[model samples]
Target: MMTAASSSGTAPFGLSVLDNALTGIGTSASEAYREVIALAQLADRRGFQRYWMSEHHAMPGASTSSPQMMLARLTGETQRIRLGAGGIMLPNHSPLLIAEQFGMLSALAPGRIDLGVGRAPGTDQATAAALRRRHDHDDRFPEQIGELVGFLEDDFPEGHPYRAVHAVPGPWQAEQNRVPHTEGLPELWTLGSSTYSAHLAARLGRPYAFALQFGRADVTSALRIYRDAFRPSPALAKPRVMVSVSVAAHDDPEEARRQTSSTAMAMLRMFQRKPYALLSPEEVAAYPATLDERRVLDMYMANTLHGTGSEVGVALERLHEQTSADEIMLVTGGHSREIQTSSVELVADHFGLPVGA
Candidate 1:
């Protein structure tokens, strides 16, 4: 049930967006990039708090192989919304490089950049090996995170090996070069779907984003673990939790369900190790799915929030109440650009977000 405040055109929690820049079966990568830019501008103008892009590799369905590059593009297109990597897979790249890239982004849009780091590869084993050339880096995710933070903050111990290695365009570099910079460092957030990330984020006292859209872990347990073990640090004084949810909302409930079906079919294909490109709703309806595939689609749809705008709004309200999350980041589910943009507009209207000039 929605609370009085929520029903009265004010949400109980902050609303944000997580875009994967998905390319559908009939759509080109160029089209996907255009749609992402449009959607990000729309979110910025509609008062959404953040507009974050995901990082994926060797996936035709997702065009955001480098979320930092996409964020760089968004820095010029967007004005108010926070641009971020929803997140960067730390195992695939060097922390110093990530720090340099995001540090430049922070300089471009001071106080509006977020760097969310994750442990997952964001690709299959073969592609991961192609990217990292090593399989053991996943086990060193925590160490990588510390190194990244150290690079961004330039706080490695005096005896540390990287103490002499300053990330260019970073805080330390700016200070050392006597550059008069007003740019703030990118705000760091830890992304995860399990308690391992929750525990690590808590111990490090960074903001935790639990990706319920991708992971099967219980959101409540993960959030509770994070909060319970959280320690105050300079980055954060209290636990901050953001939950990402898959949603498809339309004026017509049936249309919303149809749009959701496309995403479910994509997930089914991904589970089968097939190409993960999204198919159109018409294609999804025509395809003959196997029994197991049908079961998987059913399970995905059951977990997804799909309905008319009001229905989705109510569901979001209930989720906010249940999790007590500080923010809700919507992973809009659909293949059509129109449907996805409409979904965002509808939700924004439901929450009565003040339209930007």
Candidate 2:
């Protein structure tokens, strides 16, 4: 039977930010990226623990297809806050390539870089197949992960097939005979919303971040599995849990509702395989909601934290306590850039996070 960590009164938790780089109704992809950069800078300055970007392909509303590429740009622009791939979707790329990419990032940002990896394709089946033939996949995600860590740590055994392969400009440079000692590696994290990834994380002894933003997962049960099964690895001595939640917060209750509604409609369209346009609140208003649409929207948003400052804060705090999370990762909706930014600030303030680095 699954068991949760007992929660005591006034449990403390760190707060972080996750962005999809969402495109507003009238905004260009470039604009979305600009917003993302600004948001990251703000999050960094505001003393948020980490600023992570998600990866999604073929989604017209999201601009973060390559989180490493985005991190390359972000590391130069922000300071202090950890910059990470809310996940890189490991199945999409080669382990050597990922190690090299993150090794380069760690070189650039050093201790501020985090590599949160996940197994999902982060896109539709057709787009996933387009990325590389589906048959080419090994379903050996765990093996790939081990290989990735090996490359990053330059730890393959002597005479092993991959022993000499190192993330170039990484810790080692292999010549005909010699290799240099290296100590560069990004903080690694395993991300998933299911018990499968939790089990892997526990076995591997890596930090785990649960993506509750869109997952139909029981956060408490997932956390229970992770904490109960954790074993110490070089990366971590104790299990660290981060619960990622969707939030649409505003001082104006109606404004928050409008933003939440727009996001719900956009999600509904995507689920129905229809146009996934993220409309403005006014545009969304023009379309009448059918009973079925409303029902689906309500069900989809059943776990979303929506309301004024105090209202959402209470729920977030409760969630943090219930999951016994080490941190809370907040992914705000694109009600608009202003609302999104403010929502982050609002939550930060609610949780009494340090302001202005």
Candidate 3:
């Protein structure tokens, strides 16, 4: 029988700290930045392959509303871990700005930066309006992706130069510096909750990271589509698929539940309102698990691989065998930095990965 340790190929796993849990501790934005810095530092020392932040606007639960800025800061703070956005919501900003910001980050961090793009607006209609009023047609993500790709590749037409040439932190500097991005541009990935992203990743020949932490009921279907549709581009020799799983770990199961309760409740509330802060363990235990909470928990348990070291090892092993995913990206949401850090440590040790406290 195949044990958890030897069930799949030993591909490196990455740590994705998206929707990180620093907000509920009364940590201000600056403090949250520091906390993320700490997490990145720890992850780097832990031998995790990458540390990705995510983009969300007007959400009290997450601080990565500006992934570009956070990337720069994380670049300055950490040493080895590949740092980038788990995804930058493309509709929220201009592709040129995305290019510029990531271009600068690539220049600074050189080989250590990545820029994952997603098509979702990352917010509701009203908030989306607040971000880019009257420019409501930003759903043109496929077109926008082409524009961003063109800017990065410097493949824009060079006719009489009639167009205002929308290239920010243009390719000249990046090319000159010998930055090694995805396809010599930037290390890019596509984030999706459905088969759309999977098909896109396969078609584009870039790696795809599924946001299963907040995904719907079609995650397995999405992954199947991605793997089947994957086409090898010059950048990738074969298909690379990563699935995101929610994580909450401690030495004991009860302790793990205690640690995860607040975040669990927060996820429960998301069905009605936007994602918000981590709740207290006491508070989470006090609230009766509603039908919505139970439903969310069922969904979460189905998609997420959680527990202490041994249990998570088994779960991860089963996931690797089941999905054949190239990599597993864990979304650690907790109310305390200690729990957040501990979650990564548990996952690391179970995989025989070099771990740090």
Candidate 4:
């Protein structure tokens, strides 16, 4: 049987910003940022609680090179939905800088901001080196994460000399009073694709969000670890978990697949470094494929929850029932603008969720 919290109700569903992966369909980054803006607006209307952007640097496939800048931009465009990074790769910068940047964002957006952290570079090795200068080491992540948590919290205790330092400027200018350095500090979630993250999040008494879109095999194991090791915090009296799933919304399965082709191809190319393009309906119909490509296609199609509007609804409810996820964080790779805008609305309506006017 699922845990009590899992069976009680469907938790708030949210969105993850993959940016250009939706706009270019396979082409470029120029339109991707705009597509993200549009999705953020739609998600707010659709009652999705939060929108997260993953920190991916120098990855030609993703447009979110800077989640903080995107968060600030979204805060101006969106009114209610929480804005945060799916994760900030912790080892890339000092804990103090992250504290200040997020602190400033929380100050600006108030109650609608969140901070989800992860240890991986969120990119390739070369890309990590470009971001971290000489400290391109993998083992430093755990230490960096500890320091990051320390920098965000105010009371560092008397013996912790490092706590005396203010991450954001001075006391007079810090405006700790205005920023609720304590209360205004956004809700924190640990994004993990494995059991290690689940254990850490549980030990830390914070929520854990699974990146199931890529780590499909490890989802169950990770969830089990989190539940077993969970310790309650003031923020959470019980363990809270979120699963990230791929979504492709449409009334027809064939139509949805056609719409998702370039997206699938783009993801494949990200791994294979092959050339791809945004295919037209006829092109999608005419597109050729190899057995290996077809296998990749099968994996993508199986993992993604896509189909007719009602079909998606049933699948989402089932996913929630089986996993008891506190929230469903939907990640869609829209090959065009139309899908980008309509998909979230389609999901919301099918679930009987209110779309704000």
lDDT per model vs. reference? 0.87, 0.81, 0.71, 0.71
Best by lDDT: 1
- Displacement of residue 170 (Cα, Å) in model 2 is 1.6
Candidate numbers, best lDDT first, in rank order: 1, 2, 3, 4
Please report the candidate that would top TM-score against the real structure.
1
What is the per-residue lDDT of model 3 for residues 219-293, given as tens digits with 9 covering 90 to 100? 778888887888988778677777777777788877776766667666667666856666777877787777867
Q: How high is each candidate's TM-score?
A: 0.96, 0.91, 0.87, 0.86
Model 4, 225-294: lDDT tens digits are: 8999998877788988888887778766777776676566656665675533455545545658788977
Q: Quote the RMSD, in angstroms, for model 1.
A: 2.2
Which is the better candidate, 1 or 3, if ranked by TM-score? 1
Off by over 4 Å in 3: 1-21, 133-139, 158-168, 174-184, 301-303, 355-357
lDDT of 4 at 323: 77
Query: Order the candidates by TM-score, highest first — what do you get?
Result: 1, 2, 3, 4
In model 4, where do residues sit more than 4 Å from their true spots?
1-21, 25-28, 133-137, 159-161, 169-183, 273-288
Alpha-carbon lDDT of model 4: 0.71
**TM value for model 3:** 0.87
Question: Mind giving the per-residue lDDT tens digits that candidate 1 earns over 277-299?
Answer: 78888999999888887898888
Query: What lDDT score is found at residue 352 in candidate 1?
Result: 76
TM-score of 2: 0.91
- Which segments of candidate 1 are over 4 A away from where they belong? 1-5
Candidate 1 lDDT (Cα, 0 to 1): 0.87
